[model samples]
Target chain A: MAKVLLKGNEAVVRAAIEAGCKYFFGYPITPQNEIPEYFSKELPKIGGAFVQGESEVASINMLYGAAAAGARAMTSSSSPGIALMQEGIGYISKAELPAVIVNMMRGGPGLGGIQPSQSDYHMCVKGGANGDYHNIVLAPGNVQELVDMVQEAFDIADQYGMLVIVLADGLIGQMMEPVELRKPKARPIEPKTWALTGPNGGKPHRIYNLKLQAPDLEQDNIDLFKKYEVIEKNETRYEDYMMDDAEFAFASYGTASRVVRTAVDKLRAEGYKIGLIRPQTLWPFPYEAFKRPNIKKYLDVELSMGQMIDDVAIACGDKNMIEFFGHTGGVLITVDEVCDFAKKIMGGAK
Target chain B: MSRIDRIFCAGFGGQGVMSMGQLLAYAAMLEELEVTWCPSYGPEMRGGEANCSVTISDERIGSPLINNDATVGVFMNGAAYNKFKNKVQPGGKIFMNSDLIEDSNPRTDVTYYKIPVNSIATRLGKIQLANMVMLGALNDQAHLVNQDMLLEAFKKVFGAAKEKYIPINKEALAEGAKAAAEMFK
Candidate 1:
């Protein structure tokens, strides 16, 4: 396969095309504008549909419309834009429509700076639109994974009938990397037999997230939880680097994980035994993957801070070995600083 | 196993920092090395300074970011130099465009090559290709990848351009390599 130098946003667009995504609906926003620009140019060449919606709300709802018609549909936006799309995303989740939404996160509370940030962890995992719906979130550290996960997000969404999110930041969205396009899968397009796709010689199918009856709503919630349980059991993914017989473990994800990996390598070279646990599946949390008997003795949770650390705390549980280190509000933590912390911990442990 | 070498090229926006990094990355892929070229984006790439990190590895690269010190720093302007000079490793090489930067001295510990890259590109009739020229010089001096590999990268990158521009770029590359070779001696 020929390697092409592509920005992360462009890579995602290319990957979506390769994955047989037929429709893209998005509005322009900083840090993720390349995605729509790419689709606008390339989608037509591939005979796909690209639409620039009036707003992020409209774009996500349009995606919901496409997904209801059983097309592989996607949309991308930054933090504020994503906030606007939350209502539609909730509807998609509750309606169980398989769609991919990419949040190339920028710093936020509102119209925050366009720098890369991991501040949207809670909003992505917990704040879909309303009440108890869960969206499977995949965090990619670099460009290749950005492409790979978009494909994976589609597959997972199709398999489980859920909204799949590729949670990335402006940094990952903007960075360029050589990516080999995966061969197109020849799977038949599976239409949702239960969706409201114009009734064909039968009773019309109605699609809505609102269940008026209390008992029915409770049962629906229970069924959703059961599906989430299956995902938690089977789909948690995390990578352990230099973890064998290590006294300290660094936990992080996305762009921060790259920094941790570098720190781990440098510390290993310096004879300081520090391992790294990078959670690939943010929603499933990879709790089981990190719970090995040996690994439990030495795990230090690191994050962009105050956000993902909550997951680490949950995973670590009564096993109080987990500690925290972080740099918040878009402050990047250097490898040297991480290495120093690792050395201090290793020295004390020994 | 495939080996990937990740290189970061940084400097001012118009200095062709991103293009230079991209050329090498595309060239490395042509040589059958797994490659990735990522540019700094957002407001940074607009009118301000720019930089790109290109990873050409034989294996699948785990990350595209350059967290540690860069193996090479090509600073085409004062902002580039001030921003990235300290980011070069102890024994790493720094290529500063002496034509634009009058005082091109970095720390005494590392090897610094002062090339009048802009002047050379001006002589070649197109000052925009200074980034390509610096790339040629770097390949000549460091020999980190290979001359043939870089030329192959140039071909792969510029294949879509008009047929006539290919030879001009190749010549520009050769001129860059010659200039760099002269400085090393």
Candidate 2:
């Protein structure tokens, strides 16, 4: 198929359809309303289901219901909306159901502005609401990556029987770009042994996390962590740019990482030994990318006030070696600011 | 050698500034170049001053926001003109709406052209064609994408509008292109 021009929100819908997402449940929110809008108009045409829930609370629970029934279901929202869905996300995590959730983050500690932001880093990667489980979060830098991540999120969700999140910003949701539409590929079918289908002859199929005993719940936590360990070993993804024998590096992801790319290129042209480590998978966090032998310092750039810096500090294993440059409440950090910081950091004056 | 061209378009709401920039972006997509189009999104965007930034490149676009490095600035009113005149880079170009702007404190650092877009569209008997008129002038000036590709993009975007207005839009485009060519002469 020919490449088509698509805004990030529109691409999410198309990619979800390509990934065989049969049910969508979401509410209207800035920067991501197009997801539900497209699904409402297109899902029915494909004999799928689309429901605009009364609120984000209702929407995420709908995703939980559909996923428990062995259907590929998804939902999307912005920052504040995602906050309302957190408890449901915790439920989905505990239920061990396969689901895809898209969070096109906007500014927020409360009801913030409708612009791009990466402020939900801790909420998305660490825990949103009383969670002992981590959502496999993929941060995509551009529209093409957003498309790829949306499709991949479904497969990963099913693979681990977990929730996967495509953590993009409002900028990626609103910006328009050209993307080659991926051909639909069939997902490997897994038998729905635990699904709530019609019962077999006197067979018990239980799918619940309601262990009354403390030791039993603790064992559940330990088993979940063991699965997470396997994911951490096999699923961590990152991009290394110009890191060979570099003295300094910037660790960033999503939209900020795109700016870091240009800054690294321009600074390298001026003979500055700077590189970038972009972590595409935020939950796995890609600590291996920060283990360069010649690295002397690390600059962290983001759309929030150093939320991702904690991860970078841990990845670098020296909190003092990492410096942060960021703006909060939807103000974007420019490439010039990143490059200037790169110069200052590599000069050993920080 | 391939390069990125950043274009900024500003006008009052309903003047099709976003549509104009998107049309060019779609044309660039048809040309198989890397492109990004971002419009101002805020409470003020509803029937207020509006602007969009478009970047077409051979390499992946780094950022979609327009800083002070626009290669082309298209202003359709005095407010847009006053706001963005100083933002274009040195040796860049400004295509202004002469019908709505009387005087501009011209800068010698960049090329400037005053195209009578509204007048051309009025003469073409459809005021909405003003954006198409300006786009035609931009084509003459920047040569960013082929004229035919733009027309094809227009057909795709203005698909419903074309059933009744394609002929006049075509004429408006040619007339704007002709006027722009005459300016260079």
Candidate 3:
């Protein structure tokens, strides 16, 4: 397939289509409205379905209904709108249903602003929904990564029958870049024996989020824990850049990692031992990558005011030597600033 | 020539700021270069101020957001000019629409070309063609992208219906480029 220029929002939807997503239910929000708009026009051409639900709450529930019925379903929203979908997300996770949700985060504690932000890190990775389960969060640093991660999000969701979220910021969502849209190999069809579809030739199955007895719920939790253990072992992914002799390491994800990469590259060229550890999966956070024996100091860079910093601190296991740099509420940091900060941190490193 | 070009364009919402950035970004893509286009999306973009940042590089781009150090700036109005005037990198170039912007205090460190892009487009009888004129002026100054690539972008954007206006757009672009050549000489 030839490459085409696509915005991050449009690229995700196109990837979803190639991944065999047949149903989409979403509400419109700034920076990500392109997703729903593209789907509404293109999904029908492929004999798929697209619905603009009454609200974010309604849209996510619509996704739940579709996914429970044994269809590849998805929904997308920005921060506040994603917050509205948390209960539904919890229900989908509890029900053990497969669905893809995209959160193109914006600046927010409320309706903060319609700009790119990474502040929703804690809300997303820490389980915004009230539950014992966590989403398989895939964060991408660029538009190409966003496209690939969207396709992988669907496959991972079906492979584990779990919820997978692509956590991107408004910057990546709205940015346009050239992407090669290939026809992905069809995902192996998983047997949905527990689907809510009416019995035709087999015994009927009932699937819901409710488990009444304490013992039974505990057993379910135990089962989920077992599945999570497998995911933790098999799914943790991170990229190590110039870590061979890194005395100082910077940990970041998504767009922030992009900035840090340039800074690391520039600093490395200038005889600094600074490297970068970029986690592609925010959940099952790659703790192993941070275990560099020679690393003297760790800096966690993010677009938010250090929400992911806590995870970096935990992953590094030595919070004493950890530092954080970020800007919140839609403010962005530059590569030169990051390089300067890295130089300053190296000056103070032990 | 710089290895990477980071260009910013700003104007009122309807002044084709986003389209100007998109045209250049698309042309860069056609040349198989790494590119990114990020628009300022918020309430201000609804019918008021709007801007877009574009980066074309041989290497993968870092951040799409440009807080400072834009290699080139295309301003269509006074507000846009005032907002982005200081952000241009020293020795970088700025192409200002003199029809809409009155002030042209050129910075000693940066080069400024005051092209009445809107006036040229209006003379072509399509005020909306101002973005193409600006693009032409940009190409003439920076040589950031090839002329043929941009014409191909026009074909891709306008499709089969371009026959009626392709010549007009080509004239607009050429006129703008010619204006740029004459000014520099």
Best by DockQ: 2
TM-score of chain B of 3: 0.93
Displacement of the residue B82 alpha carbon in candidate 1, Å: 3.3
lDDT of 1 by residue, B1-185 (tens): 34434466777777778778877776676666766666766555455878887766776554566655667778888777777777777787888888877654549877888888889889989988788788888877766567666666666666756446766677777888898778756
Best by lDDT: 2
Which is the winner by lDDT between candidate 2 and candidate 3?
Answer: 2
- DockQ of candidate 1 relative to the true structure: 0.51
Q: Please report, as a residue range, the 10-residue window in candidate 3 chain B with the lowest summed lDDT.
A: B154-163
Query: What TM-score would chain B of candidate 1 score versus the native chain B?
Result: 0.86
Error of 2 at B83 (Å): 2.1
TM-score of predicted chain A against the true chain A, for each candidate: 0.93, 0.96, 0.97
Residues A1-350 of candidate 1 have per-residue lDDT tens digits of 76677788889998998888989999999899989998999888878889999999899999999998888889999989999999998999899889999999877768877778887889997765788988999998877788888987888888889899999988788876677787634333355697767889999888877889999999999999999999888678888888788766788888878777877777777777678888888888887655656653444433355577667767766547666666655556677776776666666543
lDDT scores for all predictions?
0.78, 0.88, 0.87
lDDT tens digits, residue span B88-162, model 3: 888899899988898746678888888999889999999989988988888878888897788887776557777
